[model samples]
Target: MNDSAIDYAAVFQALPGMVALLTPGLVIADVNEEFLRAAGRKREQVVGRLLFDVFPENPNDPAATGMRNLKASLQRVMATGERDAMALQRYDVEDPERPGHWQERYWSPCNAPVLDPGGEVVLLVHRVEEVTELIRARGGRSTGRAQGLEAELYSRARELQELNERLRRAHAREREVALALQEAMLPASRQVGNHRAAVRYRPAVGALNVCGDWYDLVDLVGGHRLGVSVGDVVGHGLAAAGVMGQLRSALSATSRVADGPAQALDVLGRYAHVVDGAESATAVTTFIDFDRHTITYSSAGHPPPVLVHPDGRVEFLDRATDPPLDARPDPIRRPEAGTAFTGGATLALYTDGLVERRREDIDTGLARLADSLRRHRAADPETLADAVLLELLPPGGATDDTALIIVRL
Candidate 1:
């Protein structure tokens, strides 16, 4: 038969497997009948469109890399002027009968450059073999030596699964013990001098272990003043909790001898430099004198405390003068800031977890916290703490450990 007289389109349609002719830019030029049937697409739907535009990688499947691999193969064919074969890929297609649904399809693809007489690639010829059935069949069948290998693989998988389960159980037990130890180290809420103090500590909901967030209230100068502290070590699990305990104890001891909040933080910074793994902790310490109606506070790389006034006005004491504990051998002494608390005023000291969120900025989270506090300013310390937590945390609960202390004067 004369080549010019032969029907090339008919021959291509009758060919086995799926085949398509694409431009150098990967635009679909022509597709065979088999390709159309395999993709559940008509010629009019795909002939003039980009390959990726017609069939995109499944948005729902994070593991899908078909589009990326196909593009790479096409580029390789164009660059080297040789055929490029790709391993099986899960290139899903849209289901025609079901909108917004996808059908998983696997293919073994090969791309070759169609060169012009001038030795330049004019088009790319892509051929695809549907390998989903073959893969499923091989996975389902086991014979002779294959049976032995399959059995060995199954046995190894079972052993590994059992080992993983045992590890999970062991981790659960450890977490429980760590949480109990953390709770034991925390101080209960009570009245210190003329101020009523309340505290709330919540562990991370999805965490398998505990964290270093903690709060404390200590009487200073023989009950003439009140010292309140909230701090967090820079990690999770037992090690962080141990650091938290040490910091809490050091803060309490330093407050007895130190003249003010700034001096206390300065001493703690010096002490943190000597302790192992205690350098990255953050804390805010405050001294309350009821007779003077004044509260002096200092921050060591921690979130500022929120003060609520009697008239329902809220303010954040955000003057931070030093880095986190142990950040330097001799950290600078943080400057102290003081504010007068009128009757019916409330003060809040909390770790960052109480006001930090993953998607939102720290300032935005702080604003939300301030708003919540203002709304519940008239409530008692315990009730106010509950209301603030309920507003900030999701129904599923917090993802990080949070420590909150509310003092009503």
Candidate 2:
């Protein structure tokens, strides 16, 4: 085309949608009014400047990478005298009004080399289309070719949040219900009549709902003879709680007759084994004879009790760690007789969860609990128990129910 016949400025200014013609080095040869206004610049500011000189911060960002690739593609087109259409791309434009947020942008490039009479490249034409609205609707950056993928992602996230909230509320309600049920099953806060008694129940820390571990202190028919019991069933869900309830009821009913700890556990185990028919199931129980100052406690597969003396010296009572009842139809070899307690001391009875977790073995875990108890010897029962539960149990959940009962005699 002859220079005298061609009207270069008129043709570029007339075309729409952010047109820019560039030199080989990405220097702007010419730009349309629409392109100048959209970039928040004037014709004098952009026409002679390189593209990188305007947006220098994002050299490695995807939009910048796309621009570099377009430059390369343009070189190919210029050599072959071919026109090319680019894949869709994105850009992030800083908004002067919004300090931290950005205005997202989408673009597609049209590039061709301008040829002279010798068929040599003299300039490049870049036609850019802004598709920001379309990009925002389909979700940014990602290709959303599949139908409804964006809406599905949004809907699933919303559903997950709603489910999490419902679970939180349900857990709170379950705790309240478990606490009320446990309170009803427990003896009065203050011991009735001549018996001076205290019962402490600490639910497992991080356990979903209040566990089935509970304590009971009832005045048996024999005068001055109170029945002290700490019990835990094998599991942690509602089933375990149900089992605990049955055991407490049965123990209360039978305590009127049985005077021995071993005998009481035997009776409880016999009842549990028969619950689902056959002797396949098991539950653990411990009964203490709190005959005034003398403490004779027995266990059925439960962790040993700790004796915290008035002098702040703590010791774990030793007993034959037998299998939880239901290892056989017969009751476990009666937990060997425990240490005799003198006056002015606290005895702590707890289920295994208080001292055991999935990460560590039972022996090591129990030793840690004993050491923790001894370290906090001066702290009172409630504080000490709470600290141990918070520190020892796993952060999220408990594999078994934990029950703690502390009594000062």
Candidate 3:
């Protein structure tokens, strides 16, 4: 093509990343050569097919979530005519030659909308860069020496992949990690005074969103007390996770120095006002003082924690709950409430995913959660955590992120 007569098709192919052009309906209009090669699919096989139809979730891996997350990102772009940058995703691709085998792949995807003159989206630019090597690099930098080491590591890993993959397929541990990609971002299980603690994190079915929900447990007063919190950042995607991470970190730092949960949250509320994307986020923080035999709690527009008695009775810590973080123009002192607990009682802190459902009242969901806790109150902390999640979550999965922490108080 001459300088004045540019070939748009050639330009699309030369865009330097794995790019796919799709209609607003998600039908693939075209794919750049890089995308076709990286995905190990011919353009003829993918173009004109729906995005999911072209690259469906790997059936062999029950933990495969690429389709759902990508679908959610694309849908968001279509809905808002905005660009969406997805977190690193582990989406396996089927081996074209092998009938049922899959090749593990990871991608950093971004979806953008191409709008018409009327400002309506006419096309969606689904761009992705294969990051399989980078993730497999496992923290290799781009320095001169690091690049060579990364290449050597990549080569060595490739040589051992067949053996490693066989071992991975034989074990369920890898699957567990894949199922909770967001879980790895959260803190691992640790001791909290004399109490036994259990934590479970499940991302939304659609977004697989690191989904703005978070949970934390911090030792206070030299192990005499424990501070725990569950919060939601009011949005989805990487942006929400960034905001959530900052708020969680701030609360973690302040909880130790603050007098109580209310003071900690008060500090966080003011901090939230300055953090981008932190507006209207909600959280519930609690301090369990062993010496006092009491639990002090404060909520910022989040669901109240549930306390299950030795028998079957449940109590909602709702007295001190207030508006969400930064909901007020100026920060005010938050309210705090405390209640004594018996020896065999249980404490539950969870994000809305455990109780909020589509087309139903929140009270109804809370009631359901309470009933489950009541029945499982006799179980131990780990057992109780698993049971509550199993019983309360929908059979398919919750559409929102869930972060649950169970403590045998």
Candidate 4:
């Protein structure tokens, strides 16, 4: 589990098959014990030597093409940044005891490039499997058994490819199930009295990156009062989705009877402490009183709601900010803020994913959101929500899930 403690170099030495590490310049950089044993040389002798220098073609055997073929494969990998596999071929290793004599060896070799973070080829990994015994058993490659061996090798490669494909499909199915569960938990669209209300939810852009973000448009007991909330769980996938669903449901029910946003969140905070995997989650809740022209808001370590006015003004409802749910041991009352809104104004409550970029400042994201709201202040709630998503998220997609609620006041 701790990658920092892992000895990757040791792993390379213990890996099966004869593997040699070569720099892009074709210099021998490192080789496993298996490679050294196959070459009949020590690590010291072959590590700093050139590939051709370590095991040059047999001087006595004029037909020796091992070095030539291997050189071509390694060059291809370097040039194309792709893997090159060579078929069965004879490569002779010089005999240590016999001095001048060389031992004949047949091998199936593959050369693959290792790329750096920038995607340039940095090293080449040369892997080989010795099949001298199998080749000699039939006396030559022209025999039926040799042909059968080649067929078996092809069969093994195909089996590996199929297994990888099945695993890919299984992963895709799992992602679909996670996404379905999240979709089922989310509340569908509903009208807020006498106003244009829009809710949007975007899943993170990766397999199994769905869930953990949600929004709800609840119709409170009083038909004139509408409840809107957006929240984010601590993690992704099924467990976080379950926590998100429970928290969203609890708040939706509690807000109906509670006095204001603060009181409703007070109960939800306590409920969160008992819910598994619900700690440290963040959410923002607001009650839009269509009859009163007032908005009461509360946050659990969430970003403040954005209030955009028609006259190039944006107000952040941050007075009620508090630590995330279950952030402390004892239960405490959550803070709440209230503000009056004029007609044709908009209120936006969203999860952090709407603004936060990987390397940019959070304030910058908040400012961008404000600018977008102010720029599109005249647009309807639906158009404004879509505009914010397009303006803030990257072209590829957001790495984290986002939940957004836009209420036209």
The most accurate candidate by TM-score is 1
By descending TM-score, how would the candidates be arranged? 1, 4, 3, 2
Model 3 TM-score relative to the real fold: 0.58
User: Stretches of candidate 2 above 4 Å error?
Assistant: 1-144, 165-176, 187-208, 276-292, 310-315, 330-338, 375-380, 383-400
If both were scored by lDDT, which would come out higher, candidate 1 or candidate 3? 3
| Overall local distance difference test of candidate 4 | 0.81
**For model 1, how does the per-residue alpha-carbon lDDT over 149-171 read when each residue is reduced to its tens digit?**
65665455446445645665787
TM-scores of the candidates are 0.64, 0.56, 0.58, 0.62
Which residue pairs does candidate 1 place in steric collision? none
For each candidate in turn, give its C-alpha RMSD to the true structure in angstroms: 15.0, 21.9, 13.7, 14.6
| Candidate 3 C-alpha error for residue 255, in Å | 0.6
Query: What lDDT would each prediction earn against the true structure?
Result: 0.81, 0.62, 0.82, 0.81
Q: Which residue runs of candidate 4 sit more than 4 Å off their true CA positions? A: 1-160
Q: Write the per-residue lDDT of candidate 3 for residues 1-409, one digit (tens) a residue.
A: 6777998889999998899899877889999999888888887899999888767789987655577668878876765567889866767888887868888887779989898765557898988888677546555357677677767755654544445446546444544544364555578777665678889888776553466999999888655889999999877666677788898999999999999999999999999989999988999999998877799999999999998889778999999989999998888999999999888889999999898865468998899999989998888888888998888875446667899998888
| Model 4 / residue 16 / CA error / Å | 26
Error of 4 at 197 (Å): 1.7
Once model 1 is optimally superposed onto the true structure by TM-score, how far is the C-alpha of residue 262 displaced, in angstroms?
Answer: 0.7
Clashing pairs in 2: none
